[model samples]
Target: MGSLALKDLTEKCTTKYKKISVTKDIILLKNYCHEIANKSLQILEVNLNNVESFKNISEATLALTILINRKRVGDVQYLKLNNYTLPQAVNEEHIILTESERALSKNFKRVVTIGKGSKAVPILIFSGCDKLKIF
Candidate 1:
């Protein structure tokens, strides 16, 4: 068997996603998902001791994780309680992170779980998400 080079096909090989306005569509999808996620969170927060509320919040959190991170649904569907925790990446003050960036970093909690291909997928959650209490 012999291999042939077809440089002429490179332009045609571009995926549709690369050629179209994927950003606009994806951003709109995420925006809609965010609204539902936020609503579910609010309901859960207000009914802290309700069992049904807990389930709704858990579902919302999972949906948010999958959407926000753009991971394969299978990747995070198996996460356990232990997977959630404070940020594992050390923030070095000397690295020159902007004040705004640093402030934003404080709100994210890091969760690494083994996903497809046995790779660790990091899921970042808002710090206050610890209140899920669904364990």
Candidate 2:
């Protein structure tokens, strides 16, 4: 399931149960936690008007907690699911990287640069797409 969907499910579960019940499968729990974090980040990226700012620090800590708790869950392969961060792996790709970039720039009012030393990359916001000339 997608991160947002998983997070919605997790939120519902947490609300319904009030307290989370742990199972023997630590991998599953860690996966859920990681997805939750990704979902939170997605919400921020979308820039929904009614949504409050998502807290990254707390979410990161929560994910770490789950990882620590699931020590015996084998080598859990955690994957981050988000449009700009990681592209969909399947042949039928849902997200187009360039289009996603444009959409995110319009919606979130920021560019999502994917690379090392991205902070060092100079940001020159322009009036039109063609007007953008990165040196």
Candidate 3:
């Protein structure tokens, strides 16, 4: 009896709920947010700081991080400071990386955090971020 109900629920979700994506709209949003983020950073540098400007930059950062990494909100939001700022881990001798991979490795750093079911999840952050090179 319980299995029947579960099956019905799954079937309804599969048939009735359709996933849709608007690529054009998403691109527009990303572009707008990117501009706002850059503007906010410039304002902050000029010491024209305000709560509103800070909020806008923070929101933009969160949106870009999620979009770029295709990560869940929960996974990113709950990330600890230590986990995110940890030194980049180099692949051990057992791991083999292609030439392009080696070049890319110089650009980005990985941060690992615990996710659902205590699984390890990795997020990539550009290495220059610590040097204030967010853009």
Which candidate achieves the best TM-score against the true structure? 3
User: What are the candidates' C-alpha RMSDs?
Assistant: 5.5, 18.7, 4.1
Arrange candidates, best TM-score first.
3, 1, 2
Model 3 over residues 1-135: C-alpha lDDT tens digits? Answer: 699999998889888866666898779878987788778777878876577777777677667667767889877667788786566555683158778887887776677888888888887765433334433
Q: Backbone clashes per model, in order?
A: 0, 0, 0
- Per residue, candidate 1 scores C-alpha lDDT tens digits across 1-135 of 223345445545764345564788877865665566567667767776767655666776676677667788787788776665333656465257788877887786667889988998877766545455543
lDDT of 2 by residue, 1-135 (tens): 999999999899888845455565666855664566566556766774424334542344334533543322121112112322342243323244577665654532122232343332212222221121111
Give the total clashing residue pairs for model 1. 0
The model with the greater TM-score, 1 or 2, is 1
The parts of candidate 3 lying over 4 Å away from their true place are 1-17, 93-95, 127-135
Model 2 CA lDDT for position 113: 34
How do the predictions measure up, each by TM-score? 0.55, 0.26, 0.72
True lDDT of residue 128, candidate 1: 47
Sort order, lDDT high to low: 3, 1, 2
Predicted structure with the largest lDDT when compared to the true one: 3
**Weakest 10 consecutive residues, lDDT, candidate 3?**
126-135
